[model samples]
Target: MLIHGVALMALAVAALLAAFSSIQKAGWLAAASVAPVLAVAGVLAAWAAAIHLTGGEKFDDHPWV
Candidate 1:
């Protein structure tokens, strides 16, 4: 899960750079190809992760500890 979240963030950063490049060199349509959906997903992922990490601690079940 940790790796997956990091990978997703990397992908989001790459997509954002690509979109900005396309918008500078090409047009809006090209810029819209990947970033919009990925951006939305990235925001949702961050929100969920924030909730999970912060709100989750209160409900944690530590069997091993």
Candidate 2:
């Protein structure tokens, strides 16, 4: 999970840089495409980190069983 988070964060950073470069060279259309990609990467990284910190137990755990 830690590794996954790290990888996702790295991807997010790369996407962000690409977005910045695209905006500078092209226009809003290029940057807009990158925005969602970066956002998803960032969210995935956060979710992975949270799952790792929570000891792999999700909210759906069958504790009553």
lDDT of each: 0.61, 0.65
Deviating ranges (above 4 Å) for candidate 1 = 28-65
Candidate with best lDDT: 2
lDDT by residue for model 1 (9-63), tens: 5655665566566677777777676657756665666655554544334546788
- Maximum-TM-score candidate: 2
Per candidate, the number of residue pairs that clash is 0, 0
Candidate 1: the clashing residue pairs are none
Q: Which residue pairs show collisions in model 2?
A: none
Q: Model 2, residue 10: what's the lDDT?
A: 71
The per-residue C-alpha lDDT of model 2 at residue 55 equals: 61
Worst 10 residues of 2 by lDDT: 49-58
